[model samples]
Target chain A: MQTPSATLVSRFAMEVASACFVMAIGALVCFGAREFGIGWGDAGPQPGYFPFYVGLIIVIASCGVLVQALLQRRDRRESFLTREQGGRILAFFGPMLGFVVLSVLLGMYVALTIYLCSVMVVQGGYRFHKAAAISVATAVISYVVFEVWFLVPLLKGPLEAWLGVH
Target chain B: MENFGNLMDGFGIALSFYHLALMAAGVLLGILVGVLPGLGAPNGVSLLLPLTFTMDPVSAIILLTSMYWGALFGGSTTSILFNIPGEPSSVATTFDGYPMAQQGKATQALTLAFMSAGTGALFGVVLITALSTWVAQFALKFSSPEYFAVYLLTFASFIGMGSASPFKAVVSMMLGFACAAVGMDGVSGNVRLTFGFTALISGISFLVAVIGLFGIGELLQTMEEGLRFEGLHARINIRDVFHAIYTLPKYWVTLLRSALIGCWMGITPGGPTAASFMSYGLAKRFARNKENFGKGDPNGVIAPETADHSAGTCAILPMLALGVPGSATAAVMMGGLMIWGLTPGPMLFIERPDFVWSLIASMYLGNVMAVVLVLATVPFFAAILRIPFSIIGPMIVVVCFIGAYTIAGSTLDLWLVLPFGILGYVFKKLDYPIAPMVLAMVLGDKAEDAFRQSMIFSKGSLGIFWTNSMLVASIMTIAMLLLFWPLIGKLIGRLRRAI
Candidate 1:
């Protein structure tokens, strides 16, 4: 049977592994950039050279640490994240991920309205009417401030043309 | 006499209605942000920068500078009234301040904190007023090697003071340096990190990164913890204020020491956090009621409050004199300076005396305003804690997204915000110090530019760094100290054992 300490160690090992995976992807991007004929001094050095090297280093270092953490002996300790704590992380990360997806499809204003309302309702536990009212008002005000008054062309997706914002 | 003339000119600009109004607005907004936990001066200033696009350079500088001072003052308010510190720099105040509040000396603690902050700010402003010219002249001597040496010192200190393992700090710092290397290479004007995205050409804005790292990252943290506000019910009476003032003379030595430490730390680029910690530690060791230090000593609150404010104020010195920002807030201010097309350096004093001096003078006025405003409104500000965090939490997230998008009018920026927020959360969980990462990110490109420039000048030989005695000495000293840190730690341990 696995001990509690062993479980914690295993969890930490998994996290290190995930971090390494991300770093590996970053390294691939760097390598691909290098292969695309971006040299250190081409046109004063391509945009990818420094960041490429940096990403490569991160991958190497992250892998080393991942291996070290996996091989380390387990020590008994309390879990840093309990199930409840994990739930809280998901509560935040889930809606945020949804917002990013929505933004691309629904446009910034509509997506913002939905995002704000959901957060206020789900995370804040606000009354439906109050959260909905606040969300809509905030989005409108921001649109006026940034788009109309400042003359910044906010990213208007196909939906905005459908809605005749122009 | 020359100093007097410069100050008079500074006053003329500062007293103008346009500058004065901007300064007042900055102070008010700064206080609001600084009083809120997790929103400190840097975030506050960065958030407000876009608003300054419409402002004249002079008005913008005054506003941002006043905000910086106000944030420093406001940070101490929460530490005195509640156990929570509004910012990292105010952490030391919570040690003794909250205990004093618990003992029903809330008014006295608030008054002392405000007054000390004001005094420290005044000292810092005066130092800048007096020494800026000399400092600028001296900083002009700095070549690329010298700059790289300073950058090295900054990273080294993070490792020295960080709670995280040295390896983690180094890795975090390298990550920041790498991030800084994104966009076009400064020396060669070649794009290095864009990875074929045209949007990446202009490069990632430091403001965008800062907004994501501090603003969005903080929202993520709050979401995880389920934001909760603890309210305080206390009436601040005038009698307590007077009582604190009467007792002020008793802690004169502590006050002076703290002010000096604050000024030194500010000038050296360590900033308010270092000054506050050093001041608090020294105060605890030397205070008359040393045993009662942690429990609640008035000196404990006074020392940190004084030092933090002073350091915050003095950080402007390097910005004005050398165009080198000592802190993140100052970096944002530098951005403002560049937007206005006014280069911050020795010429700022020579050519734009009105702008430079007026900003310095306003610090004097702004500090007084902050003290009076905070003291009079302590009860009102403390009542903010009574507001439900459920409402505040969602509001903060909305603001973070808007702030990010507003920087460039791009959803890509807003999208980047979440990943950085997660990164921040991971760093926090791992107990890695974020300060080094931030400092390195802000200074990394400049440091790299300096290194490469020096190499080019020396025909690709690294020996140029040693050719300059100042650069050689500073670099060698820091390298030696960092390499020998374990030995120093061991020696300190031995001394403790012996004692």
Candidate 2:
């Protein structure tokens, strides 16, 4: 029998991982705050004094979470994500990452066209022409609203340069 | 009476055709965003903030607050029609609103919800009108210690009233403080918590954080849920609407009680979401037909809607009078206030009476306009929910990123949205309250400054927090009580059990 529907990760594991992540951030803050002395100077608190204690509290709180998560036996068996849910999340997240990367490389308008068109066509199972029309329409509308009317310039790449639409 | 005269002046300024047009546009846009899941009031207001950058502060605030009122109304519509809360505050509305719709009383439920919300909002504005002048005048007497105590009270109440684990709340709040502490220290001139990224030299933009967390992050969660809206399309008949309006006074007790709960929560930072839930619980507990609560009781629809709107409207009072935002949306607007070179404390009332009063006057006009506009536009918003998620979802993502980029025109902010989106998604799933985090980030520097200033005044003595003045001492005592509220509650529970 295939195990395709198996639990991908347990809730307990995810909890532990997140707690560790918070703890790491807290440690980093504490470390960084030390650069500026975290003590009270003659005048008052040094720049880092507030942040140092803030970091320490974070560490302590996350530690509490970690300990609590470990002791909760009932939560250990709960599934954080099943294989199907994981696939669904990745399906949505993968395109999002691509959109960000493409927006950076090509200008945001071009990226918007590609991203919207692809997501609609591939995931939505829409006809390609319909997706293209919608995507192109969105880009044009956004251009009018933001650039023409509002006078806020967005990021542009070679396509806009070639079109002389800067 | 002086306040009444000031309000009349505010009306004279706000009655212009230009401001009225802005109010209508803001309300319509507000409804659109509010009807859509994952784009709530905070996200809508923040997204619209950049557009208001060029406008005068009075007009800018009028637009934003109008949108806010429209959003609160729109959120309940989705709850009734789709059993999905478009905003967090409207979650309680779904308890009875959806069932009422299913029972084919959509018109009645919608009418009652809108009426109650309008009534509640008006009550909140009236409260603001009466109390704001006095509060602002009182706040003018506050020094650094008093300011610190007020900020402390705000944070402590969040912990006391928050539904999330206290430890998790602490972690979320401290993380925000850490983020705020990044970039440079204004007092010491030494940059702290940047971790050596040149891009971070200008500190974390709370606007970007909001867009990422509330906007993109919410979209991610919606995606994971694989949400598909199947809304009940109701053609709201005018006669039925009129009939429902005629019946609004039957639930006067619920309306009045909920307005009070909403006002208290708003002033104390328990926020609209918590206020709505609390109001719903109380309504259910006290209802004559408790069994009808989850089965489409009209009071269920009325209670939460009233509280949600009242709390939302009243939350602005603290933001204006105390410079301590009462809600996430208020925090974002307070940031916009600073961006416009307008400080948000008691000084604002004396210094820029026009800005403060006009905004107050607009609240009276905006809510009335919101009620009229929302009732007329319900079917249109419902039609929008028919758009497939594949199309709408990606469009929202694009909107979010564009909003982020426009904040500073920095590509780095665009990248920042990614990790923050992940953090937001995870934090939400793990039951962390994101509001405190957002508030802390916004108020972090100010709170830090106040604390540091107090310490300097007291020569680094910790005792100064409570020993300074009777006002400061009493405030600190209240803050401490709130901070330990959970434990105090437990102790009381044990005593009752023993008795």
Candidate 3:
């Protein structure tokens, strides 16, 4: 059993790690942009220039945050995440992540249909027929409204491309 | 007279069927978003921004601004009836609002909140109408140095005064500013930190970060705790509505004071939460029946409600006059303005008087509509509370994703929303103030741009900050105040001990 203070210290550690992760990502992006001949310009600046500095700032500030998190007393810390709280986080996001991954493979319409149906049936406890009907109806309607009427292009996935529907 | 004529011209544009429909839809959606816990005005507006891509700029702005006003009003509804605050600003309302509901005066409390919100919104609209020109003229004198000073002052005041820990607040603010700097060097055109991902080209969307931090974050926390129902129900009646208005005159001073506080706070970056808290504190300090404050006192309801709405309404002024958003909601509206290709700033008034005036006019109209619509539909909204969290929770998640996807029409944005949501949850759990982070994110770019511009103009001499008398004084004052905050707090603590 983890004590509350220990849990808090761990949480702070997690925060520091997350910040570092973000900073690292930012640094990598800046370095890549630099390689693309996107340095600061003579006539003011280029597009990637400001971003490089921003990434540096993130790295520096995140380091400071990490240091502070490390130096902070355990008793003064607080746990923002716990195992018990993970259910709510996962329940909704789990389906969302699945939806994204599925969209890439199955295409927008089919992916949405499957995702919605699954959400309604599994999480919503709706009957199979009811979930399927609702999902299909919603997808069809959205396709008509956004794709046909609004002329907003919805991404067709790799599966659709194989079908010559690009 | 010219102002009145301009306002009339504004009404000409605003009264059109298209604009009216936009306002109504915006307000309705705003209310829905505000009533939903973990979803606030900024997120709502940001989510809906992509929809306005097809709309004319004027209609788009009117719609977004109306949504903002509507959300502020709607937030109070949840606070009063369910003891759940939809937004941080509505937290103060929960103090007396819940008590009133418990006392079987839920209808009365709801009505009073709505009416006071409307009244305060009207006051805010009037101030914007009257003072926008003057404010814009004054803002024109603000160069990059002054703008930078103003940004710094706003950041300091928001953190130092608002947060529980000034040091942590400052750190949080700097972190946000750092995040804002991640994509590009605005001045030198040098690439700063993009490690190499093509996504880094566009930089992080402030909207995405805010949505993730507050929206997804809260969703994560809600998942952890599991949804708990307190089992509250209330019936609103026509007589209760009348009673709410009759009860208003008794707290006239509180209303005026709160409205004033709301207006000033909204114009600056103090925002609705600060306004609500400040108004409640002032009301408590000066109320004749201070003992009754926390115990379902009507004055208690009036104070925060009025200020919250007024602040919400007046926040538009800064966005319109100076292109500065005082709150997250205002930031969304600014984005809307930008989408419309109508830049918000002093030039807005000169170039787009019709857009400016009409938005102001619609505030007056929207307030009346909100009051009538909310009063009539209290029972309906209350009925929504009966729906189980399980159902509402998943639906909210779907909407969150949809909203995120709508903004940039990118999968990366959708993915980004979740982390921010988790971040929001962490912030809430840790009792860190999320408002500072959101505000910092919004102002971060502007601050950077102003700093760099000022540097270029002054040939790298920091002394240019003091070259302009007004800028010099403001920066000095802000610096002195920030430096002395700890000392002031200690002195106050000692005084309290002595007392």
Native contact share for candidate 2: 0.85
Candidate 3 lDDT over A35-109, as tens digits, reads 534454444345454445655655665665567667774755556555545554667778877876776566666
lDDT of 1 by residue, B1-499 (tens): 7877988888887888877777777888788777876577877787777767777777888888888877887788887776767777998999988888888888888888888888888888888888998887776777777777666676676666555566566667667776677676666566666768887776677676677677666666665555555545668888888988888878888889999999988876677888899999998888766899978888898899889988888888987887666666776787678767887777787788788877888888888877887777677777876666655555566666666666777777877877777777666665555666666666767777776666556665666776777656767587658745755887999999999
Q: Among all windows of ten consecutive residues in candidate 3 chain B, which has the lowest summed lDDT?
A: B163-172
- State each model's CA lDDT, in order: 0.74, 0.92, 0.75
Per-residue lDDT for B388-426 in model 2, tens only?
988898899999989988888899988999899888888
Candidate 1: where is the Cα deviation over 4 Å?
A1-78, A140-166, B161-163, B470-472, B483-499
Which regions of candidate 3 are displaced past 4 Å? A1-79, A148-151, A158-166, B182-192, B483-499
What lDDT does model 2 reach? 0.92
**Model 1 interface DockQ:** 0.34
Can you list each candidate's DockQ?
A: 0.34, 0.81, 0.29
Pairs that collide, model 1: A44-B188, A46-B191, A46-B192, A47-B191, A47-B192, A47-B193, A48-B192, A48-B193
Tell me each candidate's RMSD, in Å, in order: 4.1, 1.7, 3.9
What tier of docking accuracy does candidate 1 attain? Answer: acceptable
TM-score of chain A of each: 0.69, 0.94, 0.74
**By TM-score, who's the top model here?**
2
